[model samples]
Target: MTFDGSWAEGREAPPAPDAPDGPVRATTSGETRRWLRPPWVRLIVLLVAFVLADTVVGGIDQGLDDVPVVGLPVGVVLAALVLFAYVKAIRFVEHREVAELARDGAAADVRRGTLIGIVLFLACIGIIAMFGGYHAGWGSIGAMLTTFGLMCAVAAAEELIFRGVLFRIVEEMAGTWGALVVSALIFGALHLVNPDATVWGALGIAIEGGLMAGAAYAATRTLWLPIGLHLGWNFAEGGIFGVTVSGSHGTVGLLKGTLSGSAVLTGGNFGPEASLVAILICGIPTVVFLRLAARRGRIHPRPRRASAAAAEH
Candidate 1:
């Protein structure tokens, strides 16, 4: 988390955790009109800015995705920028530090999440194997490395956008349950546009990915854990198991193992992300995280008005 990197310009301190109607962790010391500070307003602004940033950055990443060894280091830079984009936006709009992105919490989050993310997919592999869906074979170390780079570029970006921005901001207004629903729907809906996408695939992502990632953040209150989880799963899917990732056929994993049998069990061409087993595999953590969140008093009832939190710059 303390990288060989640093944000050149640090913003002001973030708001108090329980500060009135503003962001849950936004500063209440600023003077801003209520209309300007509504949670809805911040949500729209942040989403717009973040989406634009993701598009530009993602475009850049896609161009370099095939370049082999060069992609990893370059992708790292892009990933850093993506994180910076999230952190920078919070400062610019919320007038508060990004507590969820605190450097101190990053390493711990990765440690807590990465292995579990990998395990989730391994579980999927097990179920698919039982159904005669998977045919194991020798894998390529080179391919695994490629997928690792690919995952690194996308995982952090997706988590920061979904859990860090979309889910967290929405939670401040609608409460955890509402945020889970809205974010999951949107997340799944977005996946509908992917290659070989199906209604089932999108739904699977919603229940398995969006909800799970949101719950992870809800329980941990940081971005790294979700990022780690996302990365681990993607890497395992494409790198370790050599399975098609989210319908992207371009994935070159360590294993060239084939997935055969019923599409229902193997997720067919849309990848394991759409499999029934994935829903169950990813869902367990979602339930556990949500419960842990509730036990930690992380679940909040819907507020009368949205949080008016503005990021600090």
Candidate 2:
């Protein structure tokens, strides 16, 4: 499907008075070519690649489990290898350089601020625990570590596929806002498979999680910021703040907080991610990032270039 911005309002401006106006033909030259493989085809290939690789690794690990020599760190090694392999495969398939995927003008503070956000998120958890007066024992430390590892594995795969590859492809075809909304909707909708997901929860996911993270990617032009933010948000929500990260609660929260007042404020069992507070927390940063990205010309008007050319002639 060709996108000529005809359906996009605010994209068309009045032609200049001296300009010789005629029907303009839209060319694909300015459009990004990331969609050559087709979106669904790319997704299928990615799934097959990861699943096949992981299955082979799992089979090998099961056979060597009794050996006791490499079984302990085997899972971690396999996970790292999978990520590395997937990244390389994606680069090869997409035919785009890794450096091209990154935002060249991103400020260092974007990275630094991500770290600070994680610390602040943890601080919030601690403060909430103190206020709510719930204690989590150290004996559950092992469970927490295991759970963290598993969640990281799952989240990394999904994020890399969706936000990293798919989002960029669509963004290249569609304008920034167009890609942002469509991809963010898909990202949020994918979570419907999670248990106890509600309309509000899904909306929360769309606005707070997907939209916000898309803005982060747009601003930074790298996955690191969004990945860091996502990790911190989930870890703090589930691991530290004693809330469900994605409709699934941790076996033991690092610090516990009772939700006695309001579900809208605290996010009840659906977790803080479903709460309006979460909307504020996530939405605020998203708005800030959106402004910054806009200033940097990341989300500028697309057809404006054509209008400028028309004026020139």
Candidate 3:
């Protein structure tokens, strides 16, 4: 008996019609199985990485507290490194090479986001001032620089996790509206740990922090814009205005403004981020940005496995 030369190992060779049946050999498919991680699993990995980075950095910063002016810069560098690692790790795990994550006109995106954030925050404060809820005073330069550094680190870190990881993953899995709701709620819930946090404050954060930032990402598909917006909002609120941000005390501010009005309008001790006026101010842009994203086809669709199978029929 002669064997067929066309039979390859690990592949199911078709039964040769010319061969008289004696003993037939069976084989399995040659295709190698690869485990594709779902979006949610990737999101969990990103969150864990974030927590680890924050904890390690916090410990290091604590040790350097005795040194003057060194702790902040060191912490900033470490935080940036963590973000870089996160982006790299995610790219590897997802089997994608996203050059845009590194390049893609980052400077322009960040500048636009910063301008929008500053303008929106200033408008919120201006509205408060108009309503006699604000009193202005002067602050120190050292404090401003320190606050800027800290806020930049924070803005970059949070935006990477929320907009870069969670929002992006969820958008791919659940589409735009689903991502908007889930990300916004999670964002607001995270702020509940802050001092003097309130329900309305959390709700305000859900809309402004969650939805607005997600929309920003949806429009540009880059982290820089959200990071810049977050940096500007926090800096303008606490660093410039000298008001508490999410119930945290400000180190210093250029304007020593005192807010005194209804907590709903003034944002109470949680700063203007929790104010009703903030929701209104941020909501308009959120709508506009999301609309732009939709028009540009930037809003991603749900995974196509089931739909593709259906189409095959």
Candidate 4:
């Protein structure tokens, strides 16, 4: 079986105003080129590539857990290589360099995003503290460093997969708003597999990870901001504030903190990321980023089809 299309909306030039209107042609382009490199196909390929590479790197890192001296450096190398796989896959499949991972302005973007993440999480923690649920005491420096490394890897991999691969392609086909909604829902769903994940907690991750982070990516068209933001947020929650990340248990953070209060404020066993305050705070920025992205004309329009049926509607 085969499919045909006459046009791919938003991908090609529109007809001239004076050009004579004609019946939509049954497209041979998509058929011949195998669906004109369908966005869904590209999404699947890229996602598979990134996930596979990341999994391999993770396996290697985990395997080296007992090889004390060479482990960290090797893990760092693996991480870099995993990122390289993403770049390599894009070039190979998309036939272009990934502008999102481009080195230009990366440092500044990462730094800016990291700062925002730290400050935002800190504010959330502070607000929770006001309710007397958050308590902080000194924690292990070594544990903090370890947590930082882990957070960095988590941030990079996640941003690459969710924002870079998933949201980017979805935006190309469905526009920015659609991409954000999709990324958020899927990101939230993924978190449901975490320990002690509640529907509310998953929803919180959807807002923070999907909407907020996706908006940040849409604003910049770069992965650096979301990555740094993810890292900083995770580190701030687990490392500095000594809170559980998402629903992860046994997270060694910078401070030994304790929480005792309503689940709404404390986030229950799922962590402060599930708190209402966090959702509201992060949701506010999501709106800002999306508006900024729109004002900057960064949003992609929905693909148009050359069809009478579509036109009549």
| Alpha-carbon RMSD, each predicted model | 7.8, 11.0, 15.8, 10.0
Question: What is the TM-score of candidate 1?
Answer: 0.86
Return the lDDT, model 4, position 280: 88
Candidate 2: residue 61 Cα off by (Å)? 15
| Top candidate (lDDT) | 1
lDDT tens digits, residue span 1-313, model 4: 0001211221222322322121111122433445537777878877887777667655664465344356545545655666787787776666655667778667767787778888889989999999899988887766666666656666777788898789888876677778889989999998998899999999999998789899878766778889878877888998788888888766556697887899999898999989998998888778777766666566776656659458888
Q: What are the per-residue Cα lDDT tens digits for candidate 3 across 1-313? A: 0012321232222322232111111111233312336566667876788767766764664465344376458756875786687667765666554432555456666776777787889999999989988887887655565566666667777777777677777776777677778888999998899888988899999998889888877765667778878878887886688888888764356666678988878999888888989999999878876776676566765556877889999
Question: What lDDT does the true structure give each of the candidates?
Answer: 0.77, 0.56, 0.71, 0.74
Provide the lDDT at 154 for model 2. Answer: 45
Q: TM per model?
A: 0.86, 0.67, 0.81, 0.83
| Runs with alpha carbons beyond 4 Å of true place in candidate 4 | 1-36, 56-78, 308-313
In model 3, where do residues sit more than 4 Å from their true spots? 1-36, 55-68, 304-312
Q: For residues 1-313, what per-residue lDDT tens digits would candidate 1 score against the true structure?
A: 1111221122212322422222244443456534446677878887887788778767876686566677667766777888887888787677777778778647756865778888889989988998789986776776677667767878888887788778888888788889889999999999988899999999999998899998877766777878988988888888899888888885666787678888789888999998889998888888877776676567877766324433321
Q: Show how many residue pairs clash in every candidate, following the order shown.
A: 18, 0, 1, 3
Better of 1 and 3 by TM-score: 1
Residue 97, candidate 3: alpha-carbon lDDT: 48
Model 2, stretches more than 4 Å misplaced? 1-79, 100-139, 256-258, 300-313
TM-score of 4: 0.83
